[model samples]
Target: MVPFSLTAAHGSIHASTKQVGCQPLASKGLNHTEQQAGEFRSSRRLVLLLGIASASSLQRPASATPYKEAENIQYGLSNGNIRPCPGGYNPNCVSTASLNDLYSPVWRSSLTSIATSAQVLDSAVMQSSDKAQIVIKRSMPNAEYLEYEVPGLFGRDFMEFLIKADKGAGGAGEENSEGAIVLYRSIAGNVKYLYPFQTAISDFGAQRKRLEAIRQTLGWRKLGCDLKECFE
Candidate 1:
């Protein structure tokens, strides 16, 4: 008795050796043993070529995909007064205060003065802000947190301002008032896959420049050393 069965196989074999000057054994006139040796060499060459192609593909950079603004999700600030690194530490996050030495200090001013400056910033941001949509406000006993969204290439970027009116260590009114800001670039969907660490660093530089311009426009003084020293 004979048994019959049907099965389907699916696979792909990329024969790139031919493109690299490798010749087929069947087309050459040779003895059986010579032909076998040639075939083995050809197989080895094909395997090597396939391996190279795979490595190159993996090393290739990722590309940014189209972004849909409607799909973005914005998170609200945490409860309580403003603290150092309100939303915690993130690689894509930058803040005015030093958080675990990860963030750099921004211009420090009085809460009242900063509040006045915020009005100007709000107006400027409202008029020329990139992809900004939502704004959330929170007031605590000694501080305030203002969070907003800015349009990003792939997803929405978060911008936050923290204002503190507590007294300084010396109990002096001069240092009681302080303000800070932070920017968080959100990488979502295809953007994360396409943009590498280098691209993210570039984005951070550009955003810092924009923020610096705003700070200058408000006539805010830099509290720490040079901005360049803040970067890691």
Candidate 2:
């Protein structure tokens, strides 16, 4: 028979091993719970991030209207004699006058004289004599509107000039005073994809320079001039 002490020691060793194995299983269960908690935290963080993005999008302001849609719409002329182009953008047009500044009143002259001078200036600077044509001339009690067409490679560019007498500053009332407000817009022709480049090449600096030369020729002082690019 085996010794009693030896048998009892063997039993104790077996029990200790069983307890050690059972401890591992308990640890595995705790680890599984921790992994589940970690997954839950990640999911919650994702939800928060999505919620923030949605809120930010909702809080953003609406975009401004496009120029084409708003170009025909006119605004009341202010003392500055300039107004923002509808929608604040025009891809086909550029101007050397701004709506931001109060332009100095210039001495008023006859519309016929101004138009003649403009035509002469345009003919002198244009690439071809036949390319420029005066299309419209209208006169109001206070303002004169003149539009010119310049043929381009793809289409015809249009220029509109507005010359208005300052309030009570010209004509019979103020014969000696010759100050007037002048505004002009050079619009590109209707050729898709090439309109911007055409406008830039045909107008931009070239048109502005011609206008300045005309202003100097007419003995008008520069008030405030600006160049605005068309929004693509």
Find the candidate with the highest lDDT and give its number. 2
| Residue range 1-232, candidate 2, lDDT tens digits | 2345444545655565455445654565657666567556655655565565555546456554342443344433345344433213334444534443212223223333444544444444353335578777666555656667776443666666666555555455342244455666655544233354422232334334444455555544443322231100
- Candidate 2 lDDT (Cα, 0 to 1): 0.48
lDDT of 1 at 121: 58
Q: lDDT by residue for model 1 over 1-232, one digit each (tens)?
A: 0111111100122333333235654566566788667557777755665665555546456443222221333344445422333222123444544355335455554234435545655665565475565467665544455666776544556666665543443353333434433222222211232354323222454345555565555555556544653332
TM-score (all chains, Cα) for each model = 0.45, 0.41
Q: After superposition, how far is residue 118 of candidate 2 from its true place, in Å?
A: 7.7
**What's the CA error at residue 107 for candidate 2, in Å?**
9.6
For model 1, which pairs clash?
130-151, 131-151
Query: lDDT (CA) for every model shown?
Result: 0.46, 0.48
User: Which candidate leads the pack in TM-score?
Assistant: 1
